[model samples]
Target: MGTRGLVAAMALMLCFGVDRVVSDASDHRYKAGDPVPLYANKVGPFHNPSETYRYYDLPFCSPEHVKEKSEALGEVLNGDRLVDAPYKLDFRVDIDSKLVCKKKLTKEDVSQFRTAVTKDYYFQMYYDDLPIWGFIGKVDREGKTDPSEFKYFLFKHINFDVLYNNDRVIEINAYTDPNALVDITEDQDIEVEFFYSVKWKETTTPFEKRMEKYSQTSSLPHHLEIHWFSIINSCVTVLLLTGFLATILMRVLKNDFVKYTHDEESAEDQEETGWKYIHGDVFRFPTNKSLFAACIGSGTQLFALTVFIFILALVGVFYPYNRGALFTALVVIYALTSGIAGYVATNFYCQLEGTNWVRNLLLTGCLFCGPLFLNFCFLNTVAIVYSSTAALPFGTILVILLIWTLVTSPLLVLGGIAGKNSNVEFQAPCRTTKYPREIPPLPWYRGTIPQMAMAGFLPFSAIYIELYYIFASVWGHKIYTIYSILFIVFIILLIVTAFITIALTYFQLAAEDHQWWWRALLCGGSTGLFIYGYCWYYYYARSDMSGFMQTSFFFGYMACICYGFFLMLGTVGFRAALFFVRHIYRSIKCE
Candidate 1:
């Protein structure tokens, strides 16, 4: 492609807007003091079995509540040492002097205080700052009532008037109690309710003001910068490899061209015993059949997934900070993509190798099922550690497994069917002698494989420092200010993948060995593995992330994502190299 065409193509790619958050009108509301609120409620009379009266807002005296209240109130507590007595709130009642120890507390009276204090459930009920308690009228001063006899009564309920003014309540279900609410009593009725309002505070930082004010934010320029740097690097590498390989290929091509131009006597004699003529084998190339299949197959899957995700994101399916929905969608899509992976891998391999139908079926089944098993094992361990029953419930897991078996299985079968019907063909621009002219094969140190694989090191080095900063921002509890870095990293990944692929492909072809295509792809993309390994080493060496997380789960998850990234790298590199190779061969044939 020419410079102008490359520029235009980049322009097109940039014009593609697939931002998930921006696509949604609602997601635009991320202003810091944007009225998000929380709420809870409780209701009751005063008395209970063990204690005299209920006291709510007791935790306002506790450290956690102090911090919470401070944030809510927009104030900081500075006292190093402090002591404050908890308020004892109750509905006070004093019976006349004649009521001494003989009467049972019965069901009828509107005395001075309708609700009496009780220790049985003082802490049971809370609504924000209000504590609603159960109430019963007790007339006996000396405690001579029938053990359970108590009159139903009404007491003053506590209420919160302050925070309710500013915050908008999003949800209010049940009261939060330290002890779980197992079951409510039958004889007395209990009801809880909540209310909401919008609130805001002026707490913007200087940096935030600058970001909001400075420049017109667009991802295009960022993408262009990353892509330009990467493509340039890749082109340089490709040129070097291509130059070396072109020399090798020309050496072999020269021998064949000279031999074919020789006298008809030699040509006819060669043709008589030639496999190319007798067997009609006009196209013979030293291609690795399995590697070719893996490359294209993985590429197909990548293409489908990339298209699917970008489209979904463009359509507003993946909004930011909605962790639950985002994770759920990712998991579902990952499962669904298994069909694409299986179908592509199986059909492409089958076509490339002319493998038996039964073998293709087995391959598809094993590949899909093996990943599913691993995912399930990981999920099971997660469930055990977290004590969460909601982790892909048993029935859901079964259904998912069934869907994969039924839906993906047929897709693979249909792909294989399509492969069977389609022609399996290979082509080359020109064929050389059965035994071509020899050239001195370079030493292992000078081999193209080593050079192509080593290129991952430089790019990886450029980004490793940033990767550590990013990991710290993400996992080390450090503040990260640059989101623009994401665009930068993405561009780098593309550049590295392309450079490695083109360079490796050129060198392999120059060596007259198309069989190394897959190896080249793997070697180029496998840089991410080294990257992740380095990240892990850095993480272990620097941070303390083990307190709240199981290192096992963290490592396992990192491994999975890294492997996926590696596969993505391999797929991309292979496809680019194959495209260029085919283009060059076609151009030569036309000439």
Candidate 2:
């Protein structure tokens, strides 16, 4: 077959496959009597339960609150975290059908059932991540009820304040119907309706007022005060770094440019030193160019994804009320952005005179994903062993892999092919010499380690305060509502990364180091190191998290997060350094 025919056949197959999946997904219809899975969003410590209360075995949901899918009846409800709530409650599905009451019950049986109903019958209601607990009240038993009769108890007697202040209260009321009574003579299908209601009231207590305030500001560490402080701190840091950069670029570099390009100066007067001395070799193709290109490509993709996600967040598209929306957005955006990774990686690799386009494309796809996938697997394994909700079920893991394989991988290949076909050579100001230049030994302070430490620190410092709130939202059970502040901090981080990286690259160049490519990338990326450090400090010194499972999950994901940061910031740094290097080299009189 011709290439066009093959392409047409492939397209037809792809469309058919997608249509089949969509049809299969839409085939499942809601039916009565099917077991509906119940899910609660976030769980936080209400008031600390006394030892006696704890020993009473009050049903509480897993801390992670991971949702699972089942081929059962009922709609899954998601809500925001209730930070000020005092008690944790597990969401119960009617499928369990555990009898709290029995037929021909004695006084002792009645007493035990009452105790169990009070302690164990908790319902979780959520408005986004916030969850409110309600207990079942007044269980009515209909004796000798016919199987055909509707014998379900009403959930109308729930006792909890639905509203605080003047805001309307949203409550979830779920009850087992028709089959809840154990005295039914014949086999019957049971159905549960998970109902929701909004209540408005004028009266509320001071404690409710406090709870309202707590809910609004719960996600932040220092609340409004910390928000302002973070902004001010980031502004001051940016200003300082901006001033430093201005001085170096306008004054120091301008002088270097004038000295190097001055035609009146004789060969004797022209000292073959500094950045001007290595103009030819400055843009020389670095070792492991394919890897470097892949890193930068992936970084660019991340950069774009982060910016787009933040923009959406800033516009309130990803508000805290939309449970799991952020994660969904990230996954979708990342998958769609796979093409960017492929294009950048392949294009840059080609520019670096790389021959193995296939290898470059594969590395681009796997560079960040490989470590992330492995870490996720490990974390999920730990979560499964512990029976933690944090674990992605096998089905979910399969779905993720399918998405990567079918959607992301194909786009990556397409992008790589396009990039390779349109490959452009690197534009160097001066051609590289036959031999490489020797690098002089530097002091410990000026070494790569120290440079990265310094470069990474500035960017990390700009976001450290904000990072606390982010960590709290992710690891701790705090809701993150302030995306605008996060967006500002994100911009600040980028600015700091770019400025610091350029400055550091200049210093490295002045020290006769021609290997600024990877250095520039790492110098900016070192922020991840500091972020990981902060994670450690937060876990050990600040957070109340204990046990091996939580620790492993935290650090494992943290590693991936840090690695992503390294790639993202490193790319920003590399770009800034490239522009700076190119501009300086262009300004000089080269042989």
Candidate 3:
């Protein structure tokens, strides 16, 4: 076979292997005496309102007993729990009591097992974050149980349990004194010890196997091929754009340098047009310098935090299965990186010749985070009202606030002071005139809005496919385990952002528009606008999520996330534009 054919065959084999593994995992069969271990999930939310209860697993049987019984019975009867925590088990009625015993119980057997029993049959079982309820025995109208019959039935079921063909059984032990029946109440704190045992019959049904296969196959790694394709496509586009821009920039700068230096005597006679005429005003302090500096500061911090989290996720520190790890890492890293925010904001503010260090530092800390917190509070309030598990509890909210106050706030202060103390003047190739240059009216296509629209779309396209998967993971049932792919796409996104911003800035400067500082930032940051548009499309067209609580929660948090993206990307674009502008201006003769 040719190389292409061989590659295709390998790909097909890989796909088949993945499917087989999923099928095997789901269709795993256990023998009649196989041990089915129960893992403890979180405690009941309604029961533990204060959230102070520390629950532990119930080790009902000793290791020696489990090992001895395994050998004696010639089967595995015990297993270790996957998670360690005490679980709540509530009982309900097993109405269809078709006995699977070989022999019927006699009157003497019933009398021997007679004991005190509960009037109500109610119990709750919790495993894998789902709760199941089953009853102990039948109850009469007077709310009383027949002790002798119940005991006899229970004993017969336990002793003569048969694994029928194509059937399985789960045996749970309700810890109670043999001489007395335990009464369960909703409000009462009764500790119930539960154990699970799986008994698989000799014969298996096709439906059972198919159902198992379906369950296993449902959690296939999400869109691996699509993600790879997107990453490759984005990288190619970025490279092409980067090469085009680099080639044009180098050639233009080289020609301009040669012309300006060699023709200096006749320079006055020639036209002073294009970026060559704007070296003086290009580096002049932009309007609203304080706000600009604050944005850069916050953006720098966000960029650092994003990079750190992605690195951690790539190294397997935070997997999708590990609940809350990603959010915990984000919060911790953001708090720790507050110094970056303060330092960048203060240094830029000082470079702009602004002495209001206090205001600059304060705005740097609050500009993005404050609005985010307020939005979170609103969404959290809605969640609390709906009693949704997604909402952070009051205690957790307080803890986050404390972390910000104690850790993040102090670091920002220190970073700001250091930045102010080490501040230096802005660098410019030519001296600014006493008055600002008059910027001519730009055509419709050369306007800021048009430039931003053009610059933003390409970057957004590069990451939109990956963004879809990320949205599904966050809002839908999909698990995002492919962080390695996400990291690559992230790098691609940055490269695209920088290259596109540079190209746009060059165009604007070539058009003799020196007001490129804010334009550069906005041009790159407009990708966030496209992202928000995709979010709207996903919510309406691609998702089935409805109701006020979910809607509010989704948009509320998304707004904050998009805002941060705006800051981070805008900073990246502006910095790239700055470097490009400086190099071009520095390359030519500037008198």
Q: Which candidate number maximizes TM-score?
A: 2
Q: Candidate 1: minimum summed lDDT over ten consecutive residues — where?
A: 72-81
Task: Please give the lDDT score for candidate 2.
Answer: 0.60
lDDT, each prediction: 0.40, 0.60, 0.58
Which rank order by TM-score, best down to worst? 2, 3, 1
What TM-score, computed on C-alpha atoms, does each candidate reach? 0.51, 0.71, 0.67
Predicted model with the maximum lDDT: 2
What's the TM for model 3? 0.67
Estimate, for each residue in 507-578, the C-alpha lDDT of model 3 and write its tens digit. Answer: 788777888999999998989888888889988988766557656756766777778889989999999888
Q: Taking the candidates one at a time, how many backbone clashes does each contain?
A: 17, 14, 12
Please list the residue runs of candidate 1 whose C-alpha ends up more than 4 Å from where it truly belongs after superposition.
1-296, 311-316, 335-339, 361-372, 375-379, 382-392, 431-441, 446-452, 458-488, 512-514, 547-549, 587-591
The better-scoring model by lDDT among 1 and 2 is: 2
Error of 2 at 293 (Å): 1.1
Taking the tens digit of each residue's C-alpha lDDT, what string does model 2 give over 1-591?
Answer: 001111111111111111111111142222323221233333222210100111122232123343333311001111121222222222221223232221243444334434434233343444222334544333443564553443323232222223232322223333334332232222333232222322323345542233344347654556677677767877797678778777867798878877765632655455588877787689888899889989988998888777777677677564433444444455657778889889988998999989998999999999988887776667556655754334454665566678789888998999899889985889888889988888889888988898998898778878888888776666554667778778878887888889889998998899888989989989989998999899889888877765576567567667777788889889999998899888888777777
* C-alpha positional error of residue 52 in candidate 1 after TM-score superposition, expressed in Å: 38
Per-residue lDDT of model 1, residues 127-242, tens digit only: 22222233222232245476345433322222212121212211112222222121111233333221212222233233212222112222246844663565456545645654
